[model samples]
Target: MSELTAFLSSNVVFGVWGGLVGLSLLVLAVDLHQKNAHLSPMMKFVWALTVLYSGPIGLGIYFYAGRKEIAHDSIWRRGFRSVAHCYSGCGMGEVLGVILTVGLLSLGNLWVALASFSLAYVFGFGLTMGPLMQEGETFSDAFNDALYSETPSITVMEVVAIGADLLLAGSAHMGQTLFWGALIFSLSLGLFAAYPVNVLLIKWGVKEGMMNPKHTPGNAAPQTA
Candidate 1:
């Protein structure tokens, strides 16, 4: 009983952020309602969980990596693959940010977030362009594609994720579990907030997913859906 009291009383900020999270969850429940016909039970769970965990990046990856089959050469699959590819780059950038934040330099929370956000988008665009270049896309053409496609999703993700971290942490030191837990929890909220926007992107037929990107030239990148 005392433990429960400690838990409830300690995280006042967490509770506030959690209210926002709850709102996102409500939004997700409604938005995903009609999407049920379009995806399998498992795929639906995958999509929901991805949103629950990683927000835009995970949503893009779901399409990019071909989590579900829409049809052969379906726009849905192609779009997902494209988004996933961008997320791959973002993932790399976030890794570097983590290194800067706590691993290599311990530059504190502010620098860590700034580094992560800036690097994530930068790497997201670059990574997308890299594969397109190998596929015979020129720098100009690839640049346009990367910038246009990834901007919306990545922006949504970074804003929400960063906002959550700062709100939860405030002035707290990084070594504490509460700080870390709040960050994770805040990300889940971010995912919830971003899920609907991703769904709209998928619906617009402007995106696609592939089973895998065969890094080598002359190898056909197989379509998963």
Candidate 2:
């Protein structure tokens, strides 16, 4: 037990990675609850194994391939027609923002990076909360709405949060004098790497009209004759 504790304490990278994997699994659980109400026992077992072991890559694959097959038409295909239509006007902004933020950080301009990160964080968070705002509910209602309905937007926010955490970690990993520089560089790379994938998911959701404001959870109720 002592050895195990020591190993985990010393290995921050592994711990962070494991946390990310765990989060992916948690999201998978939420997806299962939302979309797999009629899945067989065997399929549930397979899903458990896939989510626990395969991590984020597994989540991506299942979302693109397996989940679509069993997913309800109301949940999966209720919105738009194609990926292209969804991704319109989503290009270059994220890429350029990341580049400029990182460049400033590399030049020891931590303030600039912090400002940019803050703005991006606010924008993403607000977008994630937009639906709830429209309803004029209490804080709890808005929070719950954001949690349950905004999966893609929530995922994007998580990516940014993870990038921020990584930036802090990179600072500590490097010396104090160079910490900001290293953090900026690391965050830049992370943003660039993740932005394209996010754009793709956005497109997928948009093409599917998954982001449409009219498609709320209440709208997904089964009809009775």
User: Which numbered prediction scores highest in lDDT against the true structure?
Assistant: 1
Kindly list the per-residue Cα lDDT of model 1 for residues 1-225, writing each as its tens digit: 335323423567545645655655455455446332333343444445444445444544454444323334444454554444444455556546755676567677778788888998888787667767988999999989878767787777667766666666544445665555555555555444544555567677544433332232233346798
Evaluated at residue 190, the lDDT of candidate 1 is 48
Where's the lowest-lDDT run of ten residues in candidate 1? 209-218
Model 1 misses residue 97 by how many Å? 2.1
The superposed Cα distance between candidate 2 and the true structure at residue 108, in angstroms, equals: 2.5
Instruction: Give the Å error, residue 124, model 2.
Output: 2.4
| Alpha-carbon local distance difference test for all models | 0.56, 0.41
Off by over 4 Å in 2: 1-68, 71-97, 103-109, 138-225
lDDT, residue 193, candidate 1 = 51
User: Relative to the unseen true structure, what is the C-alpha lDDT of residue 37 in candidate 1, on a scale of 0 to 100?
Assistant: 38
What is the Å distance of residue 162 in model 1 from its true position? 1.1
lDDT of 2: 0.41
